[model samples]
Target: MPKNKYSLIRYRVINRCLRERRYVTLQELREACEKALDISPLSDRTIEGDISAMRHDSGLGYFAPIKRDRINRVYYYEDPDYSIDTIPLNQDEIESLVFAAKLLEQFKEIEIFKTFTDSVQKLVDVLNIYRISGMDTVRNFIEFETVESNKGTERLPELINALKSRTVLKLRYKSFTSKKISSHIIHPYHLKEYRNRWFLIGYNEEFKAIRTYGLERIISIDTEESKKFIDIGFDTKKYYENVIGISVIDEEPQNIQIAFSEMQAQYVISQPLHHSQKRLNNIKDKIVFEYFLIPNYEFYAQVLSWGAEVEVLSPKSMRDSIKQYFDSILFKYNH
Candidate 1:
């Protein structure tokens, strides 16, 4: 506020002008400033002073150079190079964006990541222009729901830097099958967002294998300096194109069917059980969703979330396992 009132008003005018117009006459700009900001009187003398202060005083890098023609005179923001390259969201994309931002806000651990954006002010500006504020900012207007897997969690920030710099990771992994802890040196190939959480798919250097490690499951990660990555052979995306649950499959993934009852069909449709889920039919009172995925615990858990509402319809092995899991749970609780 050490800046005088004129200087502050000048910055606002230039910001508004740059935002609204690429080319504007001095007269047009004067009227816009008066109308938008309610200046008591519009005079070229005051406007000229504002323009001068806009360039020298404000750090916004706004420049208003005067243009003259024999028939007319005008003023325009000097640089029209407002690149959309660095822009994160436009006026139309704020709602879903706000929802995602709020979800990340929960992970208090991921506060270390750097985003070159003024997201708060930008979101507020867009919402304000449309007269959206308060709880309506998040409530029902936009939502993010995760279809969590039984896959272990990793420390998110640790993986973020590894992904950013394309570095290898030394991890203390808790293998879900054996419940064994071991050290792994992995050359991270990709970081993907599925169901709200981030997953890293990489080549495990220790086992000479490929594995998908959930950002939340990473018990601890240390940046490995001595082990150098000479080559990363596989493309991250194509590696998981067939396998659904990141099970490190041996055979090609097969199509499977799942049937959900009317009671929990809404929740099934709300958060897709998998990225490839497709509605096969809505037969009278039941809903069926199908997808191609490896038969894994994560897939089993997806169906289990529906409790009595869902039943595996195909792949005999999966159906039997689902029955046994419930039977065990029932036996334990019934006693």
Candidate 2:
């Protein structure tokens, strides 16, 4: 372990002793930390320094009220009830926690999360307690974009189980463009979410290739008990590393350059489109940005969402594709 980890362990040990034991001697604290970590005897000087740091280190945020009895040479907390475990949270932190609790409440009815139901309830109870105790300043300051009629979230438990047990799945799916439903035998690899939609990414047995299926389009899902589960050893991170959203193509990543209007540039700078995005240069009134990514349907749609405020500078193929799309739109309007 690192030196900081050891120090943290020592601090926890000291805190436990101060909270539980009375008239704890400096020697006793050292012995306790050494025994807990199963290490060599810690010196008295080291123990004293630990106590000093715990009491005065503002970075630690644990300005423990520690005092010593001169007569008995014993140390203890001035407030018996004081413990690091019950550290006070600031108003902003409390509000953020309350908001998170609200989000977690949405998943309470899901079967897989039944174990966490009690934990989530406990958090709500704590928040309520805080509210009754005069910290009732928590408000609905943040709102999340939610899909009211989102489908397939109920399949999360079964999908998660199949992923864990390496179970093959039989999925009946219908695409947005298709009227007929198709059945597929898939080796479940991963479940992904993008823009309030869930998708199943897996190895399609019939297609003999990896494919993505939107959960909203799924009609039914069942276990393929007869088929043996084939694991492709999918590295989720590496697979989606270069792509924006959930569409992962087989092509190599392109050096994508885009120029954004000044207004849109501010938003891009604040919340970057991709991890690989970097500011290239300023041209006229536009801010040029660079991204190393595999162009996909989602990438095109994202660029299109900004409309005229953003322009794809290079990879002529991508630029032409966007131009063709605009031309088609113009042709439709003109016709």
* Local accuracy of candidate 2 as per-residue lDDT tens digits, 30-107: 999999899987799999988888898876778999999989999999989888777787555666788887777666
TM-score of 1: 0.55
Using TM-score, give the best candidate's number.
2
State TM-scores per candidate: 0.55, 0.73
Candidate 2 residue runs with Cα over 4 Å from true position: 1-93, 106-122, 132-136, 147-149
Consecutive 10-residue window with the lowest summed lDDT within model 2? 132-141
Can you tell me which runs of candidate 1 are displaced by over 4 Å? Answer: 1-109, 113-158, 175-181, 193-198, 214-226, 230-232, 243-248, 266-271, 281-284
RMSD of 2: 6.0
Kindly give the number of clashing pairs for every candidate: 8, 0
Report the C-alpha lDDT of model 1 over 1-335, residue by residue, as the tens digit: 15666556655765567557766677776787787667756787777767675545434333344333435465554555542223344434566666555665344333443241356446545555553444355624655553343333335556667777878788876755657777778888777766556677888876787777766666778888777873567776667665555555666677888878876777768877667789899777888888886766556666777687777888787788888998999999999
Clashing pairs for model 1 are 152-217, 153-216, 153-217, 153-218, 154-215, 154-216, 154-217, 154-218
User: lDDT of each prediction vs. the true structure?
Assistant: 0.65, 0.86
